[model samples]
Target: MLISSSYATSPIQTYKQSETKPQNVVDEAPTSQGDTVILSKPALDLAAKEKGREFSNSFVMQVANQSNQKAEEMLAAFTYGLNNPLIDISSLNPATGNGATYTRTGQPVTDASEVLFASQNESLLKRNEILIAQEREKGTSAATILEKVMQSIDQQPQSYKDKIDWSRLSS
Candidate 1:
């Protein structure tokens, strides 16, 4: 039986207006990760040629030389070459898995992760400098505060006069 999806739903029924049963239909939504790719057949042919490469001593030496070189330099050369990357990012469709178009979740950096990491070191440094500046600005020393307190005590002779006032403390 070939029942078409288009002909399945025709009349829209309402609970408040109509006595007829309402046709409950579900709509399919398209999901996406949104990735771009290239579909170059020439690139694929070049990859096939590489896969069937006659790896002689010279080929091995060339590869070793490229590998020994810096990654950026190697990548630059490879990008310029026809057999740049075997993986065909340009020829992928999720509806039919026939190509190498897959989503990689992160941006790979050539630099160290610690370098890439954003730190509060600057803020911490600023705060430390601020604390040091504030400390410097505070001209009143610990010894000075203690001396002032002692002077105030000396001004009141009764504070030094050994009178405990035990009756008031007890009450």
Candidate 2:
């Protein structure tokens, strides 16, 4: 079976196994040609990638004949970080029991990196708000209202054309 995982954006999948002769287990109904495609472990792994595997997050591969759900679920395993933050695995010794062990608990990020990133994001958002307020103060135009006005005028020509009033008589 040929299976592949591609960029984060693509759905992960296992390769469709080449048709092998099904042993003499007779079935009542005939199966579709594609139904013969067997789902294997590799395919499931690919499925894991498909789900939450950001293309930039890991080595990406491209596979076919699989759904996106499976891949993403699998990817969740890798992305799932431990909840206990005191023991940073990135710089700890697990065997010596000095480093942290995974408690399967989720931790709210208190790292300086995360804080600074969030602060920067908030800063940028504040700047954006000011820019938008200025734009609105300038009375920036929206196309939707203009479109409606044009449509109404087109549908009712008399509204724009000056109609001759016969009731006024030949003045």
Top candidate by TM-score = 2
Among residues 3 or more apart in sequence or in different chains, the pairs in candidate 1 whose N, CA or C atoms overlap within 3 Å are 37-90, 38-90
Task: Tell me the TM-score of model 1.
Answer: 0.16
Model 2: per-residue Cα lDDT over 61-107, one tens digit each = 12101334433343322122111122124434436534332111112
**Residue 165 CA error for candidate 1 (Å)?**
56
lDDT of each: 0.28, 0.29
Error of 1 at 143 (Å): 14
Q: What digit string (tens of lDDT, one per residue) describes model 1 on residues 47-105?
A: 88766343223222233234434322322221222111112234445475444411121
Query: Which regions of candidate 1 are displaced past 4 Å?
Result: 1-112, 115-118, 140-171
